[model samples]
Target: MGQVGTKDRFELVGTPPDHQEAEFADAVREGLSASPRHVPARFLYDARGSELFEQICTLPEYYPTRAEREILEDRADEIAAAIDREPTLVEFGSGSAEKTRHVIEALIARHGHLRYAPIDISRAALEASADGLLADHPELEMVGVWGEYARGLLTLERVTDSPLLVLWLGSSIGNLTHTEALAFLRDVRERLAPQDRLLIGVDLVKDPAVLEAAYDDAQGVTAAFTLNLIARIARELGGDLRPEDFCYRSRWNPDEERIESHLEVVRAHTAHIPGAKLEVAFEVGDRIHTEYAHKYTPKSFAALAADAGFAVERNWTDGEARFRSCLLAPR
Candidate 1:
């Protein structure tokens, strides 16, 4: 955390005292010990995984990024006007904060200056992005929170009295199941004042073929992204696993209204992680569920907002309706 001159400022917010390595080991052990083993999608975001995801966004099949960016580009001014005067902009999972530039510029134009708070689990990404943003926008002041959504929100001390605008863009909410999403939204609602606004990006239900292709791109960047989780466990937790032992698979689950990503064991294998003191045996065809991307229709999302104590104020979408950015206020 440092300040440059009078214009640029940055602060790194620390997480709770829990050691990250111990937490990762515990999560891995608990996840693998369960029947129908699964890992939380959040673990898929190590440094390498983050880089691969940036590549995934540029792929032609991945429509969410482009569609969401389109809406932000077209409607940032309107979004800023809705929030009105100087407001502290808070973004969740603000990786690289590339799409954030539009909204930041719009806010700066409407008001005289901008105060931005970006919450992210990766300290490296947060610091790097914050530096670049600070260098670029002299009118901006930023505090980078190094924690997950709920924890970050709890740690976020109010920086400005000008109303709060929380941005959860890139459809990352799709990572949570319906019930989990509701609970998470409720937690967020509890943290906000009644007048505070939330603008969230959500991927829309579309052709199953399109969804499937997006997850399993021809270039195999998404595949590498999924496998990187295993590599991460091995690198960080003393797990003995080779990338060749498993294959990547993505499927459109119409019944679930989501796309599922899995790492299927191609051959019988045993993974031994000395760090966690755990051994896991996998037979051929045994799959580790890695991620889920849930797609929502407008009606479904509106109902979801209501259940979480938020009233949908407005929703902007791309021409193809592949994605949506909805504005909501606590009911």
Candidate 2:
């Protein structure tokens, strides 16, 4: 990556350094202390965890990434044309911004110039993506926002003066529960300037076997990605949580219409966290619930947008209808 953007264009916002660490320690302590133990999925994306996830995206069992990419590649021109104004494309959780190049190119091709705002919690990933994108797109102007999605959205309000097209790709919205998603979208709706639109990718409900395999792949890449959290605990929290004592597993929770990931205890052990100043004991059969990916049908998702104070402007799906990207406008 070369020809970095100007200093004023790239700045780290949101949680401060000490506070971020404190929040991580606090979250780990509290989640472990709960009866049904769990860890937040955001913590799973440390540098190595991020790299492993890139590997997971390529796995054949993981259909969402491929399916979503196909949707964008096929309809990006149409998607870009749907915008009523020349809008800056803002992407939430824009890791690597790999698939996003389709949308970026489409916007520039239509409007002749483009501005991109990428928001990410991982500053390193955000910076790297920015460098690669800048080197390639001379017509592109980028203002990188480094932080959580909420703070990043707020940052966009301050940095941008043009209409906005927010990109929430990769079916990442599935990370939130139904209630949380509604609240999350409402928060975004409250922040929108006029002419702003949101394009969000979502995984569609399908066969339980397919959903389960996507999360728990045959090559064990997905397993390694999930277990990287335990590795993170040892590395970052200075915790004596032996990674070998746990194994990764996922299930299709039909009742929830989601895939639930867990790190099942392989052997009974006690873990001591000096950083968090906490200790926990686990039984062999006990599970530490880690994450889930909720699936939705196009109809249900459109209704979801409506409840969240937005109208689904248009919905684009892949040929198999395995995934969809919904363009929305604030009601």
Candidate topping TM-score: 1
* Model 2 weakest lDDT span, ten residues long: 1-10
Tens-digit lDDT track of model 2 for 1-331: 3454544344445556677678779989999999789888888887888889889999999998899999999999999998867888889989889999999999999988888888887777877887777777778878777777888877666454678899999988999889889999999999886588999999999999988888988899989988988888888889689889999988888899988899999999899998788999999989988888999988789889999889988889899989999999988
Off by over 4 Å in 1: 1-8, 16-18
Q: Hey, what RMSD does candidate 1 come out at?
A: 1.7
Worst 10 residues of 1 by lDDT: 1-10
Model 2, stretches more than 4 Å misplaced?
A: 1-14
lDDT of 2: 0.86
| lDDT per residue as tens, model 1, 1-331 | 3335533388788675357677788888988888778889988987899889999999999999999999999999999988765789999999999999999999998997988999988888888788778887888888888878888888898755778999999999899999999999999999898779999999999899999999999999999999998898899888687778999998999998999888999989889988778999999999888889999999999999999999999989999989999999999
Steric clash pairs (candidate 1): none
The TM-scores of all predictions, comma-separated, are: 0.97, 0.95
